[model samples]
Target: MTNWLLRASAAGLYFFSAFSFAADDSHEQFKQAERIAWSGNYEAFQQAVAGLDHPLKPYVEMAFYKRHPRLRYETEIDHFLTIYEHTPLEWPVRDSWLSYLKRHNKKARFINYYRDTSDAELKCTYLTYQLDLGALKKPILEQVADLWTVGKSQPKACDRLFSMWSKAGYRTPELVWQRVTNAAQRGQTSLLDYLAKLLPKKEAYLAELYQEVRRDPSSAAGLYRFKQRSAKESEIAVYGVRRLIWRDPELALKAWQKMQAMFTFSKQQKDSVAYRFALALASKGHEEARFWLNKVPHERQDAKLLQWLMSNMLKEQDWEGIAVLFTGRDNLSHGQKYWLAYSYAKRGELDKANTLWREVAVERDYYGFLAAARVGVPIALNSEPLQVPQTLLNKVSQAPGFKRAKALYELERYTDARREWNYLTNTSSDDEKLAASVLAAELDWYDSTIFTLAQIGAWDYVDLRFPMAFKDLFIRYSERNRVDLAWSIAIARRESSFAPDARSSADAYGLMQLLPSTAAYVNNRNKVSKKRLFQPATNIRLGTNYLEYLKRKNEGNEILATASYNAGYHRIKRWLPDEAMPAELWIELIPYTETRDYVKNVMAYRQVYHTKLGRDGNILAAVLDMKIAK
Candidate 1:
């Protein structure tokens, strides 16, 4: 027999021969190998893992040593690579090996094994490696040019490579201009300033001209400041027109009329500027915006233009206008097609509505459920349970990358931890992917656990899908405020995905995603003392009280209460109509993309939670029963 089989057989026999161990079998013994490895029992781990006939053997071996900070030698990592070349552990081990070499200044060793063609940081390291060997010239300069042309600043690891390029006089005016143009399109003013300093004194005037247009588009509204015209001037005119429209669309229209008579802009530039103004005004629900939008040739119209045009029509209840927007479009999304059908229904065209609804009702989602309700069809989840192999489960449980992922989560570096967890899922077998998902849940990686299962198409595990994390707190606060317990669970699932430590860039915190100001008001009203708003019990209490207040304001419509919870109550009130309309249509027409989707997702989660809790009847039926408050 080969060496590997001998080791496997030896491992299988070790437990039986060694002692009267507490575990039942080899699988159970291998489970403890991971704990022993993390407990800093490297030698003991090796001994135990050797007596284990499981796929976790190699993973447990590498995981213990990867977390230790003192193992810096190149030869030591090289030994690891040799043993695990073709195994499932190769990528993580190799990635960490490269990181160790880079962090410790082992340049020669990094170059020897480095071939990461995709990561820009490692590519800069490649240039540094070539510079060290004195084999630099044309190729190195080409890479420097590529890196410097990006619209945003390159990562700081490129500092050395960029300095070398500057010393060699390869940084040219042409390359700087490209980067400036890219930065201008992206509104990256800081990057534009940095690139401007690299320009020659004569060409530096161009950057100042671009800045003037950016700062105040009204100055060039009539194009009366210039005696001459060039391509640069034409581009500046386009930008100025867009800015003028943003500040005052009515005045922008007047300026556009005068500029057309006074200046000659290329057809492409004129179309570009007109579309920008039209789309902006349409977003704000300007009455005359579509008159300008219709002037753009049908061939030039795109998805964004169509969406904003539809939004304006929906706000006006001009069903014919909505139909006209999609008449010639061939690339309509499922959502768009569903909305088109709804428009036809409002126009009393039942045949067309039925045809469209039939196509959309087969999938599972907010729209699909609504479509199903409209056409009297059952919602189709079409999800299947995953069958994981026992061996792959062992690999997932003991991989070094997973250990790193868990450690990062503990530190509250959620983004970094997500990337590490991704390494564990990237190439895992289907069953192993499910096992990784369970591992995430076990670690209370709420978002990762939920999203990972969705990632792998394993959607039937409702318990995993709708986790009962912090149920006691949800029940306590929800009942105290008379908020439906299911609504509280639904809000938490959508807001933070049951992550107690979740936070948004807006400083919204915890299970309910309450902003500090909102949390403070809730606390003051309840006479509770100030504490961490992200703490589970406190956040739930504040959030539920906020929900109760909204429900009272909206006449007990959970749909409007939920929408108010995401968007402020005042905004939801402003969105209310003079006449009653179906609540689903009201949600579909809401302008803010984030708030619209927030309402849809939370309501959908409400359905899932209700179904999982053994409630019967159509969930969307109750949601649609809501009427717009007059």
Candidate 2:
């Protein structure tokens, strides 16, 4: 056995298998050792994993620690955690090891091993450990109060800590009111009631009023009762008004008008109310939207407010309004610059518009493409390939974390693989991240490649950012559905980044992110099962066919079809203008920010894919040629 181990070690074999010494066979043995560890056979688990030099050896050791969990293995646990500090292996083992130390009353070791955590029990124990060591400082007491003042009841382990903090006068009436407000906001009624008892008899009534206003924001109409104009009173009124605005904007406006007359609201408070009220009014298409929006100074208008105002202006063809909104603003985003240039052109300031368009066209985004088309400039890809040193690339690829990530990916444990990959990228330097993206691309893990580049803001690496994945599938489906090939590929890329196993929180599945219902609706003649929806061919085919259906339904307009694909056809009908508009104008007026951005990205990505596919496509020609009818 010793001689055999020597030969296997010399040959770089990770595990010995009876069947064969292939990589797959070694993986199987590693898996088998994990199962044996779970079965509580420590000696057999050890022997099974013996001579293993694979990247997954740490995982096997973690499994053994779970089953054994003896303090005698502390040295090995420390070594595992130190070697795998940023990887997923560190947390579970460290958590369990801390628990073991806590249970054994090993306070010194616990303090040594403890890292900052949000776990209330661990935090309480950590503070208690400090208190036992004569740490009654204001900072320690303050941390104890932070844990104590939360809305919900903490674990029983916090009881002793709370007693100490209260004795130290850290739990004052002011802190009690703060907790009361938190509990009320979080709808922890019982906790709020308990906290109210901690206040003086006169101020306790404020807690009852808070509960009343929380339960029925309409109670804010009785503004006369709040005569003190205290900070707490203002908080209650603002909370009620904010909640009320979402329910009934007009009523919220009336209540705020009355509250402002009675209370001394600061400028920030007034602006906060104005911002929410403006958004609510604009979203509901209230006539008073413009009035409320103007109440907010231009400096305070964020992207959402700007988008809403721009949508309204585009609908009204108020080019001067759009121009005025962006004029003299040096900090405009690319989209804002495009709109500003369009406004200038519409209002006959051709020189200014052309100059701005020239600047905007240099970018590689939706607005950049549109600006380029407007000014008749060549659309720039701005491709700067990520160039990493061969030595660094080789070193990164051979890192233990990268090796384990690749191994997990090869074993089809994608979730685990993605976790490991994310950890690797998050902790790597910029060059290391670029190199990691190259490694991910080589492994055909396009999602990680795209996300890592995005994380490092390496947008000029267009090839890495927009990989040509599943080219044949996209082409075949595009032809089958009579859809534009680049368009279909762009949609899939935007939806899933070509991760076939992608599933969204909305239960959207696979490469195209099709909700099962939509897939069934499109393929009513032959239902594609949920399982097949994840397959690249089926997802592309179904998604493209659905896009085609939307196109034909929208009078063969691809822009409308793309919008309907994201925001539903029913919403598209509601959003349609009574008068005909340019397709770009109509697209800008889309109410849902998500749908609007989706359309813009899809259009831009389609153009990028077109160039990537070696086609002589003009990005501007596509946008300028389209029009939407009433």
Candidate 3:
């Protein structure tokens, strides 16, 4: 009996194992079928689906059919309609479906579905469809009534509906005005009377609205009312006088003095009025602006006015006054601190400048470099060798604006750099590959650039930008012009980092940072439209032409021309009369440190690019032969 029971148990275990294996096989088949469907192998996917039985068959079929192309108009329309009917659509996809439906002339169908559906999004979509169909006025009126009915039960939806109604040009409705009055009572006045027209019968609402306006005169609606009234009216005159007190204090005093007999006020009100009186006196060059500002209650003091006072102090180089403002509760932003540091540096307070620089450098914020550079301090973190943080390096590599290959090179991760360079050189234009080749040569890696360039057939992408497009163009241009290609590369790198859309603070645009006026002149001379100057080929053409023009103007002095390109030709020409100096010395002696540093950095970068091209030594020889000073 025991042997028979054991046999029975073993038999059951075997059966269970077999069933589990079969289930596993089915799951694997489903996964493979899904893969096939995703790859658009419809025939294989359909066969896989057919092989599935019962419940799995429907599931697999649905998955496969969801991806099927809707070639026929009926199929496309029916597919979306069915999906919309059955599924709760997400915002992004629902928006797409709505657009598709509208484009296909199914607006009525969409509106019907939207109204019947209980979903908030659906109702919103319906209202939008109604608006789009130019049947907004009726629906907007209905929505206002719905808001009153529902009250706070669906405030968000009501708000959205009200905003839509306002946007659709129904803001002047009596119902809307009533709703605005209600909203204002509840302190939700932001939307009230926004673009609302004033009704002729204003006496009923004016007193309440005026009180709210007095509480916050900065409100646009209040300002509009004050402007609309005649100057002789006491209330209008008082409101306008108060506005002018802050904005144009001198005018406010004149208006207030003229209306002295119009009204009586309490002692507190009279004292509260003293602040503006002092401001007006100060505006007329009286020292009382400071006197009143000091006497004003701390709680009542205007932060904006204080900030303005600090700004004026800074403009006057009042270091002690700036320090006083800095010590206030409102700590300055990094940018503000940087400005302060600049002021300190100009005052010859190196210790203070260094302290500010240290604070900025440690933050590793976007403005750190600019701040540190302004203070003549090298941006360092904890006395450590400046290494790009791995997180930052990874982020920069993935950034669309930065060239990954160049960024990798900068990070000194050479193997990965070579891989990216290989990819860019292999798949892009000849000029680009040539540039890659130059980079490879600098790393002592040969043939990769040539092979990649050839593989990509880089010449097909070339236009007037020539060398700017390809590494080979640089070599050719350099040889033809008898100038160092390395130097040109350096300048280009500093100007744009090779981004075609690079723009400067001075309104210089494109890869070479050409000023709009300069670009316009170049475009006109070339008979190219002003708009075309932003295009890569056009910008490069004009940029190089301008560069060449500057080179010639500076008597073939590359350094001087490069400086003139950055700091303006007129400024450089005016400064050149001091003495004929080597380019390096001239760069070092440049009055504007920005231009001076620009020349040095460009020269240094030229050598770096040359080294990357495996022509570093050769380029150095060529640069030396020019006998260029400084």
lDDT (Cα atoms) of all candidates against the true structure: 0.73, 0.82, 0.50
Question: On TM-score, who's better, 2 or 3?
Answer: 2
Candidate 3: list runs displaced more than 4 Å.
Answer: 1-108, 111-125, 128-198, 202-311, 328-332, 339-353, 361-520, 529-535, 544-630
At residue 540, give the lDDT of candidate 2: 90
Model 1: runs farther than 4 Å from truth?
1-74, 77-129, 151-172, 182-203, 217-228, 255-271, 295-304, 324-334, 375-395, 398-417, 438-445, 457-463, 525-531, 578-580, 622-625
Best by lDDT: 2
- Tens-digit per-residue lDDT, 128-197, candidate 2: 8888877756778888778977888888879998998898788888789878888888878788778778
Q: For model 1, what is the error of residue 460's alpha carbon versus the real structure, in angstroms, after optimal superposition? A: 5.7
Q: What local lDDT score does residue 349 receive in model 2, on the 0 to 100 scale?
A: 90
Model 1, residue 620: distance off in Å is 2.9
- Pairwise TM-score winner, candidates 1 and 3: 1
lDDT score for residue 315 of model 2: 64
Residue-pair clashes per candidate = 1, 0, 17
Cα lDDT for residue 160, candidate 3 = 60
Candidates in order, TM-scores: namely: 0.75, 0.90, 0.37
Tens digit of lDDT per residue, candidate 3, span 1-630? 123224534555221221122445655675666667566576787677777542233334444445443323335435544653432222223444454554566768666534244455456556655766788477445565544422123434345666666566665555544554455434444444441233334433443454464455443223334333432133434544555566655555555565554445444554566555554544333444665555556665564445435434543457766665665546676645755665676678878977886677443332454454444454322211112233333332332222434434444444545555555444444544444443333332323433454465442211111123335645565565555666655565578655455567877776567877786675564355435654656566567667777888888877778788889878788767343443322343355557766865675455445534545232222332243332
Ten residues in a row with the worst lDDT in model 1?
13-22
